[model samples]
Target: MKKYFYFLFFSLLPFGCKDTNGKKPIEITTNDSSSIYLNKAQNKNTKIADKLKYYKKSFTILKNQENDSITRSKLFELTKELYKNNFEREFLSSVNLLTKLATKSKDSFYLAQAYRSKGSFYKHQATKDSAFIYYTEAEKILKKIKHKEGLSLVLINKSLIQFDTGDYTGADRTLNNAYLISKKNNEIDNLYAISVMMGLTSLETKDFDKAIQYFNYGLEIVSKNNNIIGEFNKETCLNNIGLSYQRKAEQKKSVEDYKKSIEYFKSALKNKSIRTEDPELYNLLTDNLGYSYLKTENLDQALALFLESLKIREELNYPNQIVLSKVHLSEYYRQVNDTAKSKKYIFEALSLAKKEKAYRDYLNALKQASIIDVQNASTYSKEYIRLSDSIRNVEILSQEKFARIQLETDEIIKEKDILEDKNRSLLYTFIGVVFLLSMLFVVRAQRARTKELMFKQAQQRANEEIYNLLMAQQDVIDQSREIEKKKIARDLHDGILSRMFGARLNLDSINHLDDPESVKKRLEYLNELKEIEQDIREISHDLSREKQDLINNFVSITTNLFEEQTATHSAKLTYFMDSSIKWDLVKNNIKINVFRILQEGLQNINKYAKAKTISVNFRKENNELHISIEDDGIGFDVSKKSKGIGMQNMISRAIDCNGKLDINSSKENGTKITLNIPLE
Candidate 1:
């Protein structure tokens, strides 16, 4: 394990690690060569407290080298150490190197290595989008290389990225892929990493059994290896196993595993003290210590460790880790009932998470805030439900958006194929048409010896020309009619509708005269004139509006006839319609059909038998027109009355618009006429 550090250090010696004059050196000793001197100098320097300093020096050197496979491999190792140590500056520097190196290398192995490094860096940074970018890039390269071990690493990296990105399903798939690859290659160390990632992925998804299985598998391998990497991974797996139980609501079992995991983390932290080269591991263990406390519900202890971890993170200027600390602190305060303080910290965390688009941290903060609100049960229930629904909606929308995008892509490909097929068909048709025309022209030339043939050709040409002209003219006429209808409809509604309203007002004033008989006669005449005026107004409006054109003046004429029928024919009239809508704008044909039908309806109701109670109603819906008129007179069975001309005419009008006409009547109840028409 320690020998691997030498390989990494040497790989990074060309960048900022300079000679005496502070200039980049052209040639430098490899990490293997430098190890001997480093060991000797360690005793001499005395203050060379950790391996981090050598790794940091190595990282600086690699940053100055032009992007290449060697630089990527070295920087990847360096960054991993930096991430583990919580050396943010060194970690960032190493990531920068890897990103640059990746762009310059066509070698899939190098690209995969660089991308894997980048994924790790962003994972620590808590930027899911950035991490996903790197992980996907690494996946592509690993796929190209067909290196099972390398592919496993890429998959594990991707799995962690997915977990952080709130793609639990994707994380599970990626972790499983890594596990399968590790098993296939018989790579125990690779399997160790894969298993740990798989365990964490399952834990996050609350699959306790799967998480336990993965963790136990990883723990066994780590026990067999008995190395620092293996030991650290094993502890992480244990911690994750505990989290799984907690998520499953098995709190007691969770606490037990958490305590054991903390012990392992403490042991790992001790590695920094003895190795002088393991600052990265020290920082990682410290962070994990805080996390373990949080998991165990030791809020105060968790807060203290998180604060301490943050101090190191801030010193390193790690933006992502600082955000994480705020989140943990927020959770601590929330758990302790410090609502205001929790809110402040959590909002700060939320702001940073949103700005960085860090899905993992954002979800964490959102969940904590939601829990805090739950204390005010009555007050916060609605808010809690709203927040919960919003989170679920966003997740569902994201999944749907991805699915929709894929579906659209598939559609586009299909459309392209269809277009290509159409183009080919068109080409063939054009060729056939041209060939037929050519043959006809040739035959015509031969037949030109006869005047009859010439005359027939002229007639055919003339007919074709006339047909084209008529089609063009029809289009022009339709457009002109539509425009005229709109203009006329608007003009008549604004003009005649106002006039009729004024006329009705004038007639109402005349009703105030003192002479009873004269006043009654004048009012009766005014009412008849009013009915006529209304009918004219409706007709004008229908001519202008297409909607009214279909209605056959049902709205205008029905109420008038019902009122007269009640007054003259001794029937009671009841009309119901929503006053909110402008009835005159109903389709003209519909209005006319309904008006005529209503006229027939009133005649039938009046002439049939001695009765009262005539009712007319007009209703408009989103996509259909409705008119109903009923009379409580001597009624007959509708099927028996189907032979009536009025009924047949009504039925024909309804069918013209592909509508439905229902005439429901019984001998004693009433005669009801119902017409429904689909509207454009």
Candidate 2:
């Protein structure tokens, strides 16, 4: 009954957003009887729809069910279906529950998969920072589990995000990681992805021939396969190859390159049904081909193609593509000697480009403005040069970030990033010096005013850059601190190695030539000896158990932390413990929370407190245990309104244990933090 109504509703109701959607409306269809909704949702053959009714049903079922491995598998499928069907709200909602359930199930494989899915979600949202963080998380887990394919996919995702942010050098290194993984696995799909992305990186860096070669390689792989993936790759390779040629022509004005570009564009659009099948690509191809025709003096053909694409773009209401169409149309008019029409279109294109942030189109408009608007040519030329130089500097900064590429560790990336940052700063200084020398003789009256402003701006920029760098490096710094904890755990290997070897030797010794009575007696003796040995080991373990409890272990841990911290700073650190405090009687939960809070405090002090003396004390008073930390460093206002995660966590931890916590700080008096947990 629902199926009959689903088809009937679409037939009777008006198609939604037909003019602006570009793609045709989704047809009501089923891919499979079982998992029908999910299957159809992920089906490219069905176009796209939210299918909120089915989504809600899935979410309801998930909420009622136990979050076991089977449930996790089902949830993961729902996320995929939601993502593929363009249900962003539901996808984000589902991803959190899926990850939490995976974590609860204690399944590393599914947990890694969940994190990667989250990264994909954020990537689609264009939230690169969150996406990168999640991908790094997934990378750590997948690497530990030795899941090559999952790691490869995550790296590919990270590289794509890097490429989007203009981090071409990082993208190259990241793709190299995926490439190595793909080569090891001998997976054609993964290889195809790497080759194409590498081509894009090369293309962006202006290595046109290398880019073309990569596209050809991708094309070769697709031609030998007959899957749906191949069809998609074939079109992508054709368009990307065409784009590489188009860019080369734009750079060098090579007539042969433009001709080659036209051929590829025509090839990509050879299937006549593409206009209806994929109107978006059809529009892009038409616009690109028109531009190539305009470049080659085929004015009549160029004008018709431009008009067709322009009509399509306006109907589709894609402001970015509309700006692109207008830019191309302006060029067509300029080539035809229609100066007024060219001016009109270029000005409109510039306005729309600014509104849409279609920077490439904006540049094109500016360039055309300089040519067609003879009276204002100097102004347009100056604006064009300034924007172009700004873009170039941004690109340089991004590339310089990973100039010393080492993909082995986050530490390497951070260390190399800092080195490149210094290099970039020096480069800026050198450029500023050159500019200053050149400007010294340029209208002496304005030079002093200009220099002063430049100095102030430089100081501000330096401060901003420093803050941004610190924020970006926070994750890597946290990872380094975690290594300290792992270092302590790794020491256990030495104690267990000899015992494991002895046990293995005893197990391997079999009495092959013995009489039955003698073999049985020997086995009994061996079992008795093993039981005695285990009993001895248990006694030894229990004797040391108290020393490994949360509080005692914390004391030992903090000793190492304090020594390491003070050795690197000028501050003299002192820690005193109340010997009368009975840690064995206190719950581990309270002890763990206190330990974490102290760690956070020490970190903050190391980062922001330029203290000469730091005091950390744990004492018992009245009917409660008291802990206080005092640092004679520059302190912030106690009454300031802000969102600080560290402070919130400390307060929450104290509340969790029915404790009272207070923080007192002032600029003149430094800072003090106190915590009181009741003995009851």
Top candidate by TM-score: 2
- List, in order, the clash count of every candidate structure: 35, 0
Error of 1 at 399 (Å): 6.0
Regions of candidate 2 where Cα sits further than 4 Å from its true position? 1-54, 230-232, 385-409, 412-680
Per-candidate TM-scores read: 0.36, 0.51
In order, what lDDT does every prediction score? 0.61, 0.72
Model 1: runs farther than 4 Å from truth? 1-105, 228-239, 249-375, 386-680
Ten residues in sequence with the least summed lDDT for candidate 1: 13-22
TM-score of 2: 0.51
Give Cα distance to truth, residue 222, candidate 2, Å.
Answer: 1.2
Predicted candidate 2 versus true structure: per-residue lDDT over 1-680, tens digit per residue: 01110121112111011111123423423442324655545555654444666665667667677766556666777776677667878887888888888787777777877778777777767676677777777787777677786677778877876787678778889989989997897767767777888888889889999999988987787787655232345765787788889889989989899999999989988877768866666787888888888888888988999999989888888787787788788877887788889889989999998888767668878998888899999999999999989877866654554342224446755676799899999999999999998787675878777898999999999999999999879978998778544422322221222223333444445445377765775576477467546644743454423224446676676576578557545789998989887777887767766765676677667667788899999898886889998999998888883636566767877886899889988886878989999986
Q: lDDT tens digits, residues 1-680, model 1? A: 11111121212211211111122323433564333333333344434345556765566566677665445555655665556556777667777667667666655565566566666666656575566666666666556556565666656655554554456786677667777877887767667666666666666666767877887887788777775332245444444554454445444555776776666566545544512444433444566677778877877778888778777767766555566778777777877878888888877876786787665556666666666656544543454466557766766655454345435645666786799899999999999999999999988988758778779999999999999999999999999998666545433433344334434544565667778875786666677566656656655655434234336455455565556556555677788786644655655655555555566666667657456787777777876778788877778876665465455655665675678988888898878888887776
